[model samples]
Target: MFKKIDFSFEIKAIGYAFYFSFLPFLFFVFQFLFGEKELSFILLKQMEFLIVPFSAWWIIFLYHDYFEEGGSDLLYSYPLKAEEHGLLRIGVFSALYEILIAICCMFLIVRFPDANFFVLFIQYAAESLLYTSIGFVIILLTKKVMVPILMIVAYVSTEFLTEGSITPVFHIMSFNTEPLSLDQIIFSVLLNGCISVILFVFGHLYLRKKTDLRLF
Candidate 1:
């Protein structure tokens, strides 16, 4: 399994994940040191959940681009087919980043003992999976190098537009203040899971069918 995989790219993806997870902490520190308005511990806690996974999506998109450029040619050349490659990529990239985000959440919740741990984890996990799918779709569709920049713009704009309320397409469940009922939380997870699976399947199909050597 490991022999067929591009382990170096996996390491690089984990590093990208860490970079994204670190940004919110840096922002919080800067806000605390410079700003006159005292922010609540809850707000800082919320920032960690909100920024990290979204940043992870950005990193995921970049990694997709890297792979598209034949960055990990060894995987394509090895005995592994596209499905195994996709599975390994998702596993390695998502697992490491999810753990990093989870640890960040745990540390923040330790500071604010009153926060709901399950709710926070569910929210972050849902958003991370959804954004991962979005990244997958972006990589599969656009051959242009500018797609990542456009994707970042689209993500921010969608968040701005859907700043409140839940939807099938756009919802920032991570930063929402309301404590969700069990059904709503389950629905969010299910929805994200379905989408991620669809995107992964579609991405693999795309790789198999689309034979544009110039693109991938």
Candidate 2:
């Protein structure tokens, strides 16, 4: 299972995306090395962008390899089933990201004692998994690299431009952000996690039909 994941992750684009994903965590490194412990809410909030998006890109990258590059022809003959492979790859990447987010939250507990680790974890996990699952469905459905990219751009822009009330914790986490409440976390988790699970199931079902695997 790990070997197959490694094979899928070895792509040049995924390699770069993997490294780029860590760019947000550099703040933690800077704080540790320089003892710059005054972690402002705005600075912490800025980390949200780099954290969730690249986490979603892993499976999309695999779709490029599996379908766009003619790897699906070979994959149909592999020992593992397509759905199994997709699930394992997504599971590994999502676990790694969730672990990383926990580590950062742990460090925040020390430096920023008032920080709410529980709520943050829930929010990040929900956002990450939602987008990850979105990437899975979008890539498999359209087989186009740019569709999901544009959708993500539009989604984020709408949130920022209109400052819409579309998200659960937006007001809680935005301007002069405070530690989110348990109710907000619960709602956000349910909303995003349910959608992610539904999309994941759909993608898994879609991947099962080898004959339907064609580019748009």
Best by lDDT: 2
Tell me the tens digit of each residue's lDDT in model 1 across 56-130. 454354445345555645444556566565656666667666776676557556545666678667666766776
Count backbone clashes in candidate 1: 0
1-216: candidate 2 lDDT, tens digit per residue:
576555543556365655666776785557555664454554355445555555676667766766667676655566777656677778877888789878876765665677788976777778788888988888878877678877876776666556556764543223224556677577667877888889999888777664346322
Q: Which portions of model 2 show Cα errors greater than 4 Å?
A: 1-4, 7-13, 27-39, 165-176, 211-216
| lDDT (CA) per prediction | 0.57, 0.67
Alpha-carbon error at 22 in model 2, in Å? 2.0
C-alpha root-mean-square deviation, each candidate? 4.5, 3.7
Q: Taking the candidates one at a time, how many backbone clashes does each contain?
A: 0, 0
**Candidate 2, backbone clash total:** 0
The whole-model C-alpha lDDT of candidate 1 against the native structure comes to: 0.57
